[model samples]
Target: MHFSIPETEVRSDENGSTYVAYNIHVNGVLHCRVRYSQLLGLHEQILSDLYTFFVYEVRKVTKLFYFLPVVRQDPILGSSEMFNSFLRKAQQETQQIPTEEVQLEIYLFSGQKVKVNILTSDQTEDVLEAVASKLDLPDELVGYFSLFLVQERGDGGCTYVRKLQEFELPYVSITSLHSPNYRIVLRKSYWDTAYDSDVMDDRVGLNLLYAQTVSDIERGWILVNKEQHRQLKSLQEKGSKKEFIRLAQTLKYYGYIKFDPCITDFPEKGCHVIVGAGNNELNFHVKLPSDQMKEGSFKVTRMRCWRVTSSVPVANGTANPSSSSKCDVKLELAFEYLMSKDRLQWVTITSPQAIMMSICLQSMVDELMVKKSGGSIKKKKRLNGSFQRSDSQQAVKSPPLLVGAEVFTKLSSVSLRGLSSSNSASDISGNDFHGNYAFEGIGDDDL
Candidate 1:
């Protein structure tokens, strides 16, 4: 419930009208942004209520019956008709108020969904438990699964937007995006591939994993040859969920999260690349200008540090440009990679989803840290009794949201920054960069 307005920016709409946008962060993570007009109108509504309350108190104390014959005029309402209309439209879209209960359709990696009723005040953990209870997922195994906001692409692939934080309200987070392409998807959360066996031991978990693996194959996320594909098909036909998953795990990009084709400065500049993150590494398939493809991977253990930066375009001396004026604001992500004992290399990638990629990398590092520290796996307490498995059902489909394409059209340019040891070694060694554990226990041969 804690909130903070950490940053504010003056932004302009397509009509050239300027407005101050306040970025609202809840529990340290960016939640939503609101315009000045919207906040002003909301403030007016609160003031109106206070005015009514004070008037009633005064009338009671004074017993002002003598003023009853006088015509009383109500306070004038605020002139934010646009804000008022926005509130009304939001209510209509959600079909419920803050206090009312809403049904959230939580999707599994298998593309099946389970409907759970919750209030707007419910947190991510609450919804996860509700979905788990419906699926009859064991409490012990629950820790292995988490909810993610994934964008289903038009081509059947999915881009993971983020793992919903425990403090985040899933319904509000998803709805606030104002895009139908996003959904709350349940997926395995651990980074170590060794944990897959633990999940496969459970019937419900086995089926969920099986369904997701098959879906990945069908969507071409997992690469396989003719012989491997034929073998997998035979196991799948035999209803061998365990064997299927075990085999699929050996394939390329099995547990990796694949991103849409983006531009990266790896191997060559302006190379069209497809990136996947998993197993504590980033696998890249770059297509050169000559139509040749090159493959490369970057291990998290070799990274010294990484960051995501956003820059706005400014024209001449003006920080904000006119609506018709076009300027590029680059959204870039860069990471420092260890090449040798004393040598380092910086890799940069430009994409609208750079933020998500950064998050995935950080998550991988965190998972490894926990594993290396031998920390106990965090699990939620379970409810008594097991429930029946829900039938596999197709999720409600909608047109994919072209968020990246829209961003490119709105922004002027995009580029990433690189760091050299001679220029940034001190800064990297300081608190600014925390990935110093690159050489701790993992060696070059291990990577």
Candidate 2:
């Protein structure tokens, strides 16, 4: 995420205690208010996660040189302590691949290799077709084979296989961590029964995919061992039968649990914000005891920037009774939000329970951004007859930051054509094709 620190304002509470409030802009929009301490905490968490991801990625590379006995015996290359230092050089070499062309090696089921030259913009389908044509495979049998990206892990094994989506294309630059030239295996698809079953099972990496999905909710990579999984199963079994069914269904369909702290609001009571991804967009709802409400949502891809801020409450006189100051320390979000209809507006979120909600949404958006940019960039054009407005009258960019009802006006102006309402608490977790990954109950919002 792109971020910048803006001017600071010193805010004082009723007791005259003051703190410096830092204004941060995310994606060129005022996103939120945060103090120094909160920034430090968030930074620490982010750094820890990055460190782990980097280490895991680097460990995968070390496996490539494992068989070179002479290289291991060399003092500079052999020492475990020097792995971190060599990781930098390895990454640099990977990134140095020529920009115009990429070399790909296809590993066949019979332990054969075929090298191909292709442009970075080439689609995955082209590779499959090329391979099939070379092998003289009939059209009927073509579907039996699938291409897989062989990614290594921190465990010193090439067990991670990322299945390429039909729509996916190779990255244009080798500098990207996901550059396609690293490794590609043109083996029989899961339908093929002739290959080594053990190697095929390892290539699927269903456990790793589930772990990654769970990390999205848990906000960190957690190695849930067999014992912990058993405990979770036991707890679900002892509780409501419906809960157990739901848990089993979630594991079967989505391959992850819905126990995110931000999703549940953990220890905090009262009404809280609910956020989820749907149809290339972010949807939010507020759940209360009496009623459920739609807080409105913005397109995940259009958010140009964001910032966070915090509220400092001062002690008030007992008789005056400012309980809000004592119980509700709000975390505000300021962001440049892009509406589905191409309208742009500045958004600020100040709900006390929704402070961490921004972080959760941010993570989902990062993934969406990657997928959206993976292929060709599609430029959407306005229809000729819709609303009948002239091209000159249309807005090329969103106006300056708008707050309050105006923000809602810009957001609601966009049509909600295929949007549907479902009971998230009761519905069984499934593939998120409809974009409702989280529960949506309605409640009133002070915003």
Candidate 3:
């Protein structure tokens, strides 16, 4: 029942050419030797086809064992007795374990770890509530915070992988990753920066914000000048958590989610840039080939629409064309940028982390809309397993800007084609563009 690919070995073919092969083992016994190219080829196949291929292979093995005697042969083909014993032991072990309750370790924004007990079937919402209860967070204010699956980097910085969805079981999702570096950290989730004032009123919330802000400064996520740093250190000594947060907010990229380096087709094509999302804008630090860096910002309000596109390099023939080799996926995040009152431009950025960029942008827009409506940020309501807007909220005049892959494909054929041709600002005015195309919300599925 235990399967592992122990190691890879270099081997020679009949033509005396060297290639690498993997030793696939099952329960300490070698089952098969697969070449690197073969594995790549298998991976290239579509998921449904690959599933069918595995099923067919299993059937063949089952039939071969069916006709064989019960006598033990090579260890590669495990004996029937041993197989049945493993199955029985597995069943017994499964039965002995209690699935009703499980212990989960959740981390706070300040790197504080706390353990809570919850049911195995508990969803993210239930787990969040349990964590909040442990922290004694007010019920009304619970919506201001969320649980995130974050990956801790070796250099002390951390990456926000994704926000845990309401429907997902946090325990199962974290366990399935099989990595210790990934942890569920509770952090403030509201878009409005001013909301931090409300959170600071509570002792626990104030400490959480202070810890996170200080961590961000030390981790170099927030930029602070020498004098500002000195002031922050003084505040830290005085235990001024509120003042520290207030000062930190004045620093560049404060409250922003930073993304890894990516390539953007802005100012010029294939410009390397570091992107950050926060304060209703996508901030960029473009690094030029001449070793110079230029700063820019894209406001969310001016973004007419945006979409994420992904393609496997192997399929696109951008990688090894003749050989079936596994290749990295290429992802592009394209947004309609308002150049002027009547002019729009399409800006595209290429990065493996494009989806995350899109999510952050959409989240920023959601928060902006909430702030514009003069209402408090509320948790998105889930109705029948989907998000539903409450009737109390005013309808947004502008259509949804965040789009998925399918809509991107359609837009590529129509809007892209139209936009490619040069037109005056008056020709494609804001009113004309908005009136012509209607968009829907990106929805929970994009997460």
Which candidate number has the best lDDT? 1
- Candidate 1 Cα misplacement greater than 4 A, ranges: 1-21, 25-30, 33-97, 317-329, 380-447
Q: lDDT of each structure? A: 0.60, 0.36, 0.59
User: Lowest summed lDDT over 10 consecutive residues: which window, candidate 2?
Assistant: 410-419
Give candidate 2 regions above 4 Å deviation. Answer: 1-204, 210-271, 277-280, 288-290, 293-297, 314-329, 336-369, 372-447
Error of 3 at 362 (Å): 1.2
lDDT (C-alpha) at residue 343 in model 1 = 59
- Between prediction 2 and prediction 3, which has the larger TM-score? 3
Q: Residue 30 deviation, candidate 2, in Å?
A: 23
Candidate 1 lDDT: 0.60
Candidate 3, superposed: residue stretches over 4 Å from native: 1-99, 314-328, 378-389, 392-447
Ranking by TM-score: 1, 3, 2
**Residue 201: error of model 1 in Å?**
1.2
Give, for candidate 3, the lowest lDDT window spanning 10 residues.
412-421
* Residue-wise C-alpha lDDT for candidate 2, range 59-83, written one tens digit per residue: 3423211111222222222222233
Tens digits of per-residue lDDT, candidate 1, 1-447, equal 112343466777779998766554332334555665665555455456536543443244221211111101111221123322333333333333365699999987676899999877566777888888999989888878889888878976777767876535688777767788988889887767788888898899898788878887888889999999999999978988898988998998898888888998866689898888887778788888888877767767666666554444554643432233333445567777764456576778887667678767756654654555555345643333212111111111111111245323323222221222321121233112222225334443443
- Candidate 3, after superposition: displacement of residue 82 in Å? 43
- The estimated TM-scores of all candidates read 0.67, 0.27, 0.65
Highest TM-score model number: 1
Per-residue lDDT value at 211 in model 2? 28
